[model samples]
Target chain A: MTRLNTLLLLALAVTVPLSLLAGRVWIDPFDPALPNAAVIFAELRLPRAVLALLLGAGLGAAGATMQGYLRNPLADPGLFGIAPGAALGAVLSFWTGWAASGWALPLFALIGAAGAMALLGAIAGRGGGVLLFTLAGMMIASLAGALMSLAISLSPTPFAMSEIVTWLMGALVDRGWADVWIAAPLTLLGLAVLLRAGRSLDALTLGEVAARSLGIDPRRLQLLMIAGVGLTVGAGVAVAGIIGFVGLMVPHFVRPFTDRRPSSLIVPSALAGALLLLVADCLCRVLPLAGGELRLGIALSLLGAPFFLHLLLRLRRELA
Target chain B: MIKQSNPTPSVRVERSRETGARRVSTTLDTNGGLECAGVVLKARLADVTASLKPGEVTAICGPNGAGKSSLLAVLAGLLASDSGAVSLDGQPLNQLPAPKRAQAIGFLPQSAEVAWDISVETLAALGRLPWRTSAAEDAAAVQGALAALQLESLRDRPVSQLSGGERARALLARVLAGEPRWLLADEPLANLDLAHQLALLARLRELARRRGLGVVLVLHDLAQAMNHADRVLVLDLGAVVADGPPEMVLTADLISVVWGVPARWLGEPGARALLPG
Candidate 1:
């Protein structure tokens, strides 16, 4: 069963890239009459595909890391307020006119994510359990959301609110290589941190006392996990807005494949997430929707909400 | 009556006064033994002083807030002591690095809820974390532990799908895979059925006798403790009231005074029991 899951994941890895490369709308390479197609392929579609892969991988890995660290399958970057924090930061950047400057949105997003995580850590305190941390995270997320709403409400220009709303809803439409470049390095760094944390995470599955008995310092690990999640989710939101459900869904989808080990779940979830996002993007392109340009976040959430509800019901049953 | 045997001949003993804590010399008697003096445990754990010998299963018994878990935590090295010291083989336990200490000590908490839904074999493999063993060796250890626990049939099943008793056995397999010299289990028998409880106790006793492993268990059931434990360390309100053989430790006065419950010891030598008054 495990080998079959691995083979399935490998197949998905191969096919996702091929599908990304083979789009239905073919671009003519050297036709002066079709420069627009060349530009779309070179500048928009290619970068969007790459960004989708990177963002998906980052969020999935981040989700796995969060679940392991918190010792709860329900844990995700969004649940911990990292995504909303990043969105708030990006909105602040745009409202302050910093979006005119290169990389400013990402910078602000990173700062916001780090700040929210720090606040969460403070509220949770040393030796505090997951309940405390989750409560703190929920509080911070609500505070950030309220502030974001206020920012949108008080915007002087009509374009500001529309831009804020668009960003909040998340879109990968106009993302180019620059956004990809900015997110890629940070995502890779986050992945590295989480992968190195695999052994500790496994130890943690037995609870803090057991992990401590295994020579793991849970407090230090929690801090590291928070920082890693912050970096990945912050960078992702900066590039793609508040893309929901990927962080929550990807790890769970790939868990059975990894035999449910945190060590194996990290990388596979990343690959699975990248594939899911790429497929969703492709569907957005081909679907005959009225908007023609479907919001990636909306499409993902529409598919992911039921899955999330199912998981919640399963967890409830298990607990019962 | 079985008397305490002489310390093992192969073991080495040393005493150091550099930390201003009482030093207990290590001696490897036929049975693995542990000695602690002036040991100041974690911030919450009160000062504790005790000695334990192998060939005997000792149960550390106390009320909910009696620092029983904290003491176990200290002995397991999960929490570092603030003042006193613990020693194994006369070497200071606090002085060793965390992983090295873990190799010598196996700990099982009252309730261990695994976060992931991993297969039993993979979960057992985690026990070899402190060892520099190869993947094949780790696999062998996992298999051995599973077989010992009679969990071979359930090795491929996810722990989440297992029953409560099965989950406990699987975790026991994980701890056994570590092959620690000393076993410190905190309320391990809680939530288990009568059959599983008896089975677990029997397994622990077998391990202690066959491998000469020092077994320290924290139990709430005075009756079970008296029935299975060779020695009983009774704690009340964070202080040891009695530390001796089960018959002597489970006396009526101590039981009533420490537990605030009326109980009596029944039966003759070799088949003694605790009965509710």
Candidate 2:
């Protein structure tokens, strides 16, 4: 591991313990008089923190791979439409009262994600270039977003409509070990797939022709990107709603510290992403809000928009 | 325009003899070179056939839209022809595994761009992607490539910070680090200065003569081709108009008919210049 990776790993170690101890009802690990403290540690905080790490790592690694594959710094896995497709499936579950069952909701979301991946692959065609793949993803995202809106508007009950809207805002509140069980394996598998694509992504930095000459199979690369992004973003939405900015923001924070090769950036980005999410979730728990904790998705978006503007301004200055 | 003082051919023959012995001692196979048997690429190339040999520098010269770049791409195995096949040593090029083909042939595209702000040394080391050998071997190859391109001083600088000529040299150095049996480049001198162009031409000739490497360059300058190349292949429209030694193939009448410029050669053989009528 590089120095940057080692540093990020150490930071993650520190943040994990802090995340468990900093909730609304703070638990002092050294104190013995508190009631149900062990239950809170085991039942509530542990699963949430683990879920945050898994989902955040998936998104961060996916972001770095996408940027490298597209050769565009602004690329994020959310652009692939898998997240919105999963959200649409979850929204449909709520609208039909099927979400009352535990497994049906997540199962439906996974099916939705699989459908989007299939659609994207079909539309991009065999051996299609990155430009075609990107345009296809944009089309799928718009279609899924429109369908979700249609489902929300046609809800039979106002309570169902409210539930769909709040879930779309994205949070990890009241999530149990079941959510962790669903996300953990899929996220790890997705990270493995993304890592496999890293060296090929580095080859693509020299343009399509040069990459091909360097023995990179474009078709294989496209398949890996689709599979990796679909699994990570889809599973994340199935459990935690639409956590957006962790993917886009985490890579930028970790890039300057590394050698800037896509392969070298992935592991570090994943670690930094886990740390950022754990810290942010801890803050959400500790802050006093009359209407409950701030939604993780909403809070990230609030921070993300300003950071995006700052990036654009800096890029423009560099160009000038 | 031939110069009596120039002993380029004799000097090249002596170097080839020395490298020929070296090639036999090593495992280098020189019996079968890259060959395209009657390749046709849908209005871009028509029945183009050429057998390129090692220890020679061949220049492909043509006007714009004359299929120079397409031919180079086909030869580099980056493009598939509409009909016919390209073979290396009697084995079909398409049948060879991608990594194996990459190990044997290095290609530099006309407008290759770096997507990230990596250092020059890092960019050169990317050539070892197909090898993935030991750390010491990879570092030595990268160091040699940087020295060949006169980029050793700028090895630590980011590619984005280099001048246009320096960047061109850096990209070519990447192909050099691969240490392939053949090197194919398309319009590599487009952005280079005169001094850099001459230096690069000399380097290619040296690699071909001393290392027994086959070099195919797509050059726009007739003077460079006439002065530096051991053999010249001229394309008019989409067909091979002429193929032979530079002096015999690049005549004034052929230039008038093919380039429609009515140009004539001036200066000595080793330092030739073209003047338009």
Candidate 3:
């Protein structure tokens, strides 16, 4: 185990309890029997904290798998268009007046994500060319993005638009154990698939022909990636709306811990992602923002965009 | 340093003659030769036939589009031919599972596109994917390959950061670490320097002579092919123009016919040969 991976895991463990402590009401960890302190800690903090940790790990793993399978270092979970598809589904849940049905939005989002994944597989061909796959993902994202915009534009009520906007920005407020149950199993399954498919990713470093010659079927590798990303990112976006940058940035941060072996980077990236999102969620609770509470996704985007810009600059310089 | 100069050809192939000592239940290694009979790749092969005997180094040399690489790819199962069959020890090549086939044949493509900065040790260890060897066994094989290729000093460095010649040796070490029965490399000597190229050829020749590993390589240098390989298979426009000993196969007339250049072969027997046009 590298020092960075060890630190990331240590950070994950420490950040979990810290996230539980960062709500509007300062619930003391030492005191158990205060007025509604246990209620606030149990009913509110625990689920949100656990959900953030797991979803962040899923996104991180997804990012590592995408960059590896596509053979591009800058790749992320959202590159597959699953995130946008999930957003579109969640938006439809609002427009169709099904948002009131506890499970409709996330369920709709999962279906949309799965559909987009299938479309990507069909368009990219069974051979799994990086350019073709990226183009297919872009097309899927564009279609999903267009549909989301159409839904927002065609809304009959302004209140619905506002509600939709708030949901789309993403929040961890008032989430319960039920939300955790919805996303946990799927994310775990996805993470397992991605983690176990390391051999193919490692073989892929030698390029398609060499990887194939090494007994790795490119189609099988792509299928495993598609299924893995679909379940985790789909369930994640369905629950938390569009949490951007966790997938893209965590891999780069954890990459140094690994010897550039894509397989070994999975766990470290997962741990770092959990740490990042937990920190972000904690920041959302304590930061003195004017608008009651800050959105978790907005906080991630704020941290991610500049990091992304920096990476772009580095890439440009490397190319130059 | 250099394993040795041109080794005396010994017919002791790597396979153990003690039949009961075999570990695996598969018939993967029961037969000896890697044979391609009437193999027809759509645009690449038109019922081509060739065979590689155990513990013998064979070189296939030809022009750019002479299907040297395609032939190698077909042999390595990297390309599927429309017709004909490839058999290993008499069993069909495609019938065997990927791991079994990989166990029998190690392939080195012309260029392996590396996307990350991985250490040489990690790069070499990837060859053990086909077999689940014990940790000690894996370590020994990786170390042995590195030592054999004289890459132990560079083992800790990132393969992506190595010089072209160094990277080529590292990649070769990766394939050798697997200990496959046959090695099929496509123009592996192209990026290597003159000394390394000769050293590599020497090493391959020794591997065939001592370990009984069938070493097949694609080469552009006719003199090098004639000097190092026991036999030469010359391809021209996807057809085998010549197949025999170096003396019988690489004549001046054959060079003109295949490579489209008139060249004179100048050298004595059992000595370095040079092709000057």
Grade the docking of candidate 2. Answer: medium
| Candidates in order, interface RMSD in Å | 1.0, 0.7, 1.1
Question: Which number leads on lDDT?
Answer: 2
| Error of model 2, residue A163, in angstroms | 1.1
**Model 3 chain B, poorest ten-residue lDDT window?**
B12-21
Q: Chain B TM-score for each model?
A: 0.86, 0.88, 0.86
| Model 1 misplacement above 4 A | A1-25, A28-37, A121-129, A316-320, B1-33, B40-46
- DockQ for each model: 0.66, 0.64, 0.58
Candidates ranked by TM-score: 2, 3, 1
Candidate 2 residue pairs in backbone clash: none
Clashing pairs in 1: B7-B29, B8-B28, B8-B29, B40-B84
Ten contiguous residues with the weakest lDDT in model 2 chain A: A119-128
Model 2 vs. true fold: TM:
0.94
lDDT, candidate 2, B26-119, per-residue tens = 1223359898866777768776777788778889998898889999999999999877678887678899999899999999999859999988
Per-prediction TM-score, please? 0.88, 0.94, 0.92
Model 2 Cα lDDT, one tens digit per residue, A1-320 = 88998898998888999899888899887886789989999999999999889888988999999889888888888888899889999998998899999987888888889889999888778665999889889889999999999999999899999999999998989899999999998988999999999889888888989888888889889999999999988989999999988888888999888778888888998898888888888888898999989998988888888988888898899889
